[model samples]
Target: MKKLPHKFQIPLTVAIMLPIMLTAMPAVMLYSTLPKGAALFEPWLDTVTRMVPFALPTLLVIAGSIRFVVTKWLVQPAPSL
Candidate 1:
């Protein structure tokens, strides 16, 4: 498969990543708001936030590779013009 332009990849990655972060955010915040006696993973939550979006880039690469490989083996290539 031909490489997709950044214009497409950027948005594509975001579409895959946003839901993951949204789901994790509340869990993190609720943990932080827990009772004082509870372990405060304040620093860890901060770190997780920064590290969170990173999964998108990796996801894009892996998904693209899988599609490309599957198309090569299982998909019939388009006939040349």
Candidate 2:
């Protein structure tokens, strides 16, 4: 299979992370907050819709910041021979 170009990395990351984060986080939140057998699908859908606009930008910014910090300060330099 052909690999995607490097330019596609960020967009691909967002595409993959978006659904996983959106589904998992809201499900967990609703599961804890709603009553048992209190009808989850509608509320989970509602929460996901409400979260969509904010989620992408937030994910990008946070991921970029962490990547920057890790590369800048957290990673160790190779030891000299």
The whole-model lDDT of each prediction reads 0.72, 0.89
- Give a tens-digit lDDT track for model 2, residues 1-81: 999898799789878987998888999999999987799999999999999889878877998999799879999866689
Q: What is the lDDT of residue 59 in candidate 2?
A: 74
Model 1 root-mean-square deviation: 7.4
lDDT of 1 by residue, 1-81 (tens): 889876598578767777777557756776777776775566556657766687668877997998889888989987789
Write down the RMSD of candidate 2 (Cα, Å).
4.6
TM-score of each: 0.41, 0.63
Q: Which candidate's lDDT is highest?
A: 2
